[model samples]
Target: MRFIFKTDYDQDVRLAKHGGHVFWYGLLLLFLLASPWLLPEYWLAQLTFVLIYSVVGLGLMLLAGFTGLFSIGHAAFLGVGAYTQAVLSNMGWPFPLSLACAGLLSAAVGVVVGLPALRVKGIYLGIATLSFGFIVEEVLARWESVTGGNGGMHVKEPSIGAWKLDSGEEFYYLCLVVTVLSTLAIVNLLRSPTGRAFVAIRDSEISAQSMGIHLARYKTLSFALSAALAGLGGALYAHKIQFLSPDQFNIVQSIDLLLMVVIGGLGSVHGAFLGAIFLITMPQLIALGKDVLPPVIGQAPGLQAVVYGGVLIVFVLFEPMGLYGRWLKVRTFFSMFPFYRRGMFKRQKSFQKSDRLK
Candidate 1:
């Protein structure tokens, strides 16, 4: 196994911990830079969706994974962002301004939702968010003046001054830049004191409060940050799809976003991207399965839903830490070689102080 002997705080908080990390990440960057030229147009569009979903997954991960908050209506924030961009763009606003407005609007709504969240926990919090999502969907459909209602609205291609990111190749570069920047920002945030506060809240609220962390402030901040990221993703998605509809941001979409983070891994940034990739690619895998299976089974009406539910159940029950956790196990096993023990990664049974007292 590789080991680091740190001499200073700089090394402790360095983004790349080792020379190996820099080399591998650099190679990955080079591959991403060459992707547009290497892949077909259709695959490029798929890659764009993966990046967009990754943004959404990151938002959910921030709250659910990092801050111990549960939300089932993040799709509402995403809808708000999409509608904000579509409305502003149609009113002759610049793409950048519209996108910024989308994030701000979503954050405002998140604050409102978070107010109720402060008083609730667990299933009640989920119900509150779910209700908010329904309200947003109703507004999108009934308020035809703003959202175009059930008919939907079109989004113009994003452009900066004279340069337009209208083609698949051009848009891929835009997504790549945003994704990299966002990933770096999150990595930095997770290393900061504020990030430590979030982890504290996740581990134990009483302990975090005793340590001088304001529960209300940090919880609200988490909601706002999560909503802002979802909004940004929604804005990009609108421009990429060139259309917006209330149906697109319903409860189902929110569930899918949750699945992305849960199946990828909670409390890890890398898990978000891994989950997004899995979500985006699962449908294609099912399509491929159709050719191998019998016609009747392949043409089954609810097969996709069944497969999705099955996969989710498998991950939740068998791999509680998700795909990223599995990767860690494999990596550690190889690193330790014959020295690895059978129960090295087993979950330990333990009780919290509150639980023990009770």
Candidate 2:
């Protein structure tokens, strides 16, 4: 095991705490850079999607994981971003400008949603967001002039200057760059006072307020940031898919986004990436397994749904902290092998006396 000795506050808050972090992150970056050369065309497309989903996961993680504010209407923000990008690109806007506008529009909607949601918490907020999503869906369906209603709308390929990012490889690189930048931004945010305030609110909103943290401002900020990330992801997704549909951003998609962050590991940036990998790869793996299994098992209707739900249930029941959390436990266990305790990974069930009232 490696040890980190902090000599100063700067060293303590450094992005890479130890030499091992630098080495591993560098290696991961190198792998991502070379993935296009290593993987086939089909896998490359899947990887691009993984990167996009990771962006959405990061957004949800920021809001729910860090700020303790959950939303089930994130897909509505995604739809907003996708439509904004589509409309702007159709109007001949530059890719960068379109993307920025998409994010801003989505963030604006997020602030609107957060305003009333600030009065609620937990399940109530989730329900509020869920209703908001349905309302957005209806609006998209009726606004045929803009969203194209049930027929959907076509999206133009993103371009920079005279160069079009038309090919999968080009798009993969674009997504990679965005995903990397988003991840770095989140990591740095978590290391800042705002992120700490978010965590404080998560731990205890009352206590955070006692410490002079403005609950409404920070809560709204979290929603805006989360929605902006979703919008950015949606913009990329629209260009990648070359199509837009309100149905694509329905409650199911929102649930999938939720599952990604929850299964990846709440409150961990790496968990978002891990969750994205799982979300993209699991379906393909299931299909591959279907081909090998007996006809009855393989041909079962809704097998994908069953398997997906089962996996989520398993993760919730056995590994609530998700894949990253499990990995952390394994790493720690090995690092302190002989000293590891049996109850080390067990979940704590204790709560405050006030929480016992209801």
Candidate 3:
């Protein structure tokens, strides 16, 4: 095993802690930059979707993973961004401005939702968010004048001043840039005091409060920031599909977003991208499997849902740490080789302070 002796406090917060991280991440960046040229148009489009979902995943991870907040209506925020983008784009607004507005509007809505979140936890918070999502969907459907209701609305191609991202390749680059920036922003946030407080709260709210962290302020901030990222992703999704529908952002979509964070691995940045890849690619994989299976099994309308639920159950029972956590274990196993232990990554249970006092 390799170990780095830290000589300064800055090393603890450095983006690239060691030379290996720099080299590997540098290579990964180069590969991503060259992917358009390497991949076919269809695959490139799918990759674009992956990047967009990755942005949303990062946001959800921040809220759900770091802050221990659960949202069942995240799709509502996504819809808010999508509709906002569609409306602004149709009115001939610049892409950057419209995108920014989408995120801001979503964040504002998140704050509204977060206010109620202060009074609830766990299942109640989820129900509140879920109800908020339903309300947003209804508003989108009933507000025909603006949202076009069930008929949906076409989204204009994104443009930066005179430059239009009309082609799949151009749009892919745009998504890539946005995803990278969002990842960096989330990473930096996690390194800051605010991020530490979020983690503290996640581990134990009472302890965080005792440490002088304002629970309400940080929780609301987490919700706003998370919603903003989801909105940004929604804006991109609007352009990618070029159409907006209320049903597209309903409860099903929120559940999928939740699955992405959970399966991708909570509390790790890499989990967002991994989960996005799973989100975008799993459908295709299922379609391929359908070709090999019996028609009754393959053609069932609920096959995908069944598979998703089963996989989630398996992950929750066997690997609660998520894909990133699994990856860490595998990597550690290989590194440790003959000396690896089965209990190395096992969870430890702890009693509450009150229990200890008893």
Candidate 4:
């Protein structure tokens, strides 16, 4: 009887795993690909923005979530990509070629920025990147020729042959496909041995070093990959808005990206999507809350900023793992149901101890 039950349980687990992989991915692919056809232009535009930042968020996740490198200045690379694409496209270059140039330019900047990582880690690395962001913002504001100075510039949409994608609805499909592909690419990369090495390095520099992983190489590789992805997203954003401005990609924007990564859940792949959505919609949501509430309870403008800051603080203070982590707990709890234990709220086990044990 015991042996029969064991066999049944193992078979059930295998079936569940198979179903999960195929069913979930199938749903995601269909939604991302078909969303433009299904939703109104408003929601489509919102989803496009979500996917755009999600590309950047995932890159940051790979760096901060997997490798323990918290980059607060990734906006600089984003600005580089946006400006490059804008300049190239304005100069009459083809869209695809210009987009490629944008990503490569950001990757070059990422490599240069990563050089300082050889001597710094943790908060110091974060400070270095933050300063880089400020410098980039200053350059963008000051460089009238390349960056268009404080006034900003326009960007042309991608076109090929007779079919011109001219509407938000049309751009929605392009953004969706690009986002889906980027997400899948990252997903595949993370499942490989290289991804595991990235996680191992995140767990412990000393331990990872002992295991023969070149810290400098993988670290720089993460930054380069992250910047490249951010650049791609920037180019997409440029097309989506059909405009470019230095103010759009500023230090505050970099901090907002970090907020998205944190609130969505650091390290979890799906959390990037969640983070982007929340970070984008939070102000709106909070405003709605004010309207929905009684007049006495209405949130003031200053309160919005306070609430935003509070959310970040609360997440970091109470649950450092972010929303996806909490979602996992909710899932595990319901999966077990009445048998759920109280300790479910403790914490998830990370890849390594001591490094980010707090």
TM-score of each: 0.96, 0.95, 0.96, 0.89
Cand. 4 Cα-lDDT: 0.81
What's the C-alpha lDDT at position 214 in model 4?
93
Cα lDDT for residue 143, candidate 1: 100
Off by over 4 Å in 2: 347-358
Residue 166, candidate 3: Cα error in Å is: 0.4
Which digits, one per residue and each the tens of the lDDT, describe model 1 over residues 66-178?
Answer: 89898998899999988998898888788888989998999999989999877898899999999999999999999998889999999888888778777888888888887
Candidate 1: count of backbone clashes, pairs at least 3 residues apart or interchain = 0
Error of 3 at 251 (Å): 0.4
Please, what are the lDDT tens digits per residue for candidate 3 over residues 180-257? 999999999987899989988888999999999999999999999999999999999999999999999999999999
Error of 4 at 75 (Å): 1.0
Which residue ranges in model 4 land beyond 4 Å of their true spot? 1-17, 293-299, 344-358
Q: Show the colliding residue pairs in model 2.
A: none
Better of 1 and 4 by lDDT: 1
lDDT to native, each model: 0.87, 0.89, 0.92, 0.81
Candidate 4 lDDT tens digits, 1-358: 0022343556643422455667887887787778878888777778889888998888888888877888989888888988888888778777778888988888889989988887899899999999999999889989998878899888876765456678887777777777778877787787677787898888778998999999899889888988999998888888888887788888779889989889988888877988999977887788778878777668455767678799999999988778887876777787788887766455336433322221
RMSD after Cα superposition, model 4: 4.3
RMSD of each: 3.4, 3.5, 3.6, 4.3
